[model samples]
Target: MTDQRWAGVRQRVEAAGAGPGSGEVFGAWGHKWVVEEPLTRGELAELEAQTGVRLPEEYRAFLLHVGAGGAGPAYGLFPVRRVRGRWRWEGDGADLADLSRLDQPFPDQGPPRKLLDDLLAQRPEEEDFDEIEDFDDAIEAWDERWEAVMFTPERTSGAIVISHLGCAQREWLIISGSHRGTVWSDCRVDDADLVPLLDDDAVPVRFDRWYTDWLEGAERTALSAP
Candidate 1:
């Protein structure tokens, strides 16, 4: 079933690559529509064994059929690779994922809304300070508090950072718990909490839908380029 959904994905990606203005897509230069080689079943099994958690089925299928990672949404999907006999995803901010804790459940809620609001309210503004050095010092202190709330390892258990969207933004794939298989947008850089990526109908998008939507959109953009 998964194979059927991903059939010819490589061909489609190649076709998009050949389209006019394909390079205009954000992060196009990084992947150039090149899907990395798919992972073998044994390799996949080994990765799972090492991580101690089975990847979401759709993502597992993607790794098996479509490609381990490449030419994906944003600046391309971060590819997982074996290094020093251990499998790890390589990309900007990819290490943010605590692979050792993937078996844990992703928390249903992040820091409380009121807490986030308080933190934002406390953020320092350069214009508020007369001296630039004072502003920098104040902002540095505020940033430490902000990172403490936002960048904690527990904030994203059971998730993997999948794609980087530049400017400190990235996407996450949930691997365990109730939200398993869903793709989420991380906008913490913009002082927003991690939230589910919604579709046109405002539905939480799963891995297959997320990837396929991006592929189809890219194809349309390529074909329409004049």
Candidate 2:
């Protein structure tokens, strides 16, 4: 999509908030921008080289054509260089995905889902034997597996950090895996976490579409206001 479409959204977003220094959040959904700028072709290339993975084509275009790091959901699109800081979790600070592993295929979700479901169903409500330690061991094992898949970088290989949603939430764009170009939300606090951004049709939403939707929604809200 043309960068011009984003310009109107930026205008509306700016009008909603006094300014970046005003500390006023914009949009009904609490979106705002920070660190507004555009990335050069050379910079984009260097980022790809450093990360060892190509960004999704549209996202790459956005960085080069649209502004680099502003006018997006949450605190806005993190400057590519600044992504490393927000890439990790708040509690343990584990990197979302290792730079070296960015090119690796993301693991299949089906296997892990089955493992978790089966283990959860088999969990004992009451220990028949006197071995309480056995129950503890089983619980720990399950937790370790769950954490690895839920919060670690390795589980989400081939995805790059997109934006921070605040309060321990984040957004990611798949770049190297089978479901590449799709946007996924990492809702760390939610029970069903790491879901794809799906539209009403249930098709996975890509970077451009997800962003456009946000902009359009903000515009509609702007127009409908009293």
Candidate 3:
């Protein structure tokens, strides 16, 4: 019922994705294409629903391309890789393709914790999309002035990278992984307003990372971190 707006589109995507081993699918703009197989319609719907915000129309169009052209180096959209099993790209500095993949084996070694540090150190010869990093740093710097928590855009629909500051360190909350865009933010509101939207039995839960992962999706996840 929640997916009624995109039911026709979703049906088409689910039909196409019905294979034996599809692992993931990328959807945005108006086009839905399978990224990996073996995934189910329910799972994909959950992924779409997780973000709260819907994907942008233009973005879905690009997603229909589905890495068909290899996510070119100039468009700044082609340089995506998985982070912590989630797809992310900061697109403002250094070659990030090798750094974006999260499922690569650590084996007996260790996680590439230094990957960000390393990327920061290198100088990419291409057009600098590193401005996205500058934006992230700005978000981190400005998050200390709030109380309770604040989402970049509080309670609404459409594409937005929500930034919720609960503690000192910031968390990135992403609603959906497709649109890769950010919304604005709003100050504190009474819980009574939000409570009405909740089901009777649904316990209030915390959403630090999911509220802030827009940067991972839209390159502005840390916009509200302290």
RMSD of each: 1.3, 5.3, 18.7
TM for candidate 2 is: 0.71
Q: Return the TM-score for each candidate structure.
A: 0.96, 0.71, 0.22
lDDT of 3: 0.28
What is the C-alpha lDDT profile of model 1 across 1-226, one tens digit per residue? 4488788887898889999968776689877888899999999999999999999988998999988898999889999999999999999999999999999999999988899999999999989999999999999999899999999999899999999998999999999889999999998988888999998899899999998999888988876758
Compared with the true structure, what per-residue lDDT tens digits does model 2 show for residues 93-194? 224656677788765573367765775576454365368787777766766766765666667788767777666677877778888889888875543567
Best by TM-score: 1
How displaced is residue 25 in candidate 1, in Å? 2.3
lDDT ranking of the models: 1, 2, 3
lDDT of 3 by residue, 1-226 (tens): 2223322433333333343222222222212222322223343344335433343433332333222112111121222334475544333322212322212221221124463244334424324546877756554443332222222222222322222222221112122332123222222222111111112455322231221221133222112222
lDDT of 3 at 19: 33
Off by over 4 Å in 2: 1-32, 82-94, 108-110, 119-145, 222-226
Quick one: best lDDT, which candidate? 1
Q: Name the lDDT value of residue 89 in candidate 2.
A: 16
Task: Write the candidate numbers in order of decreasing TM-score.
Answer: 1, 2, 3
lDDT of each: 0.92, 0.64, 0.28
Clashes in predicted model 2? 2
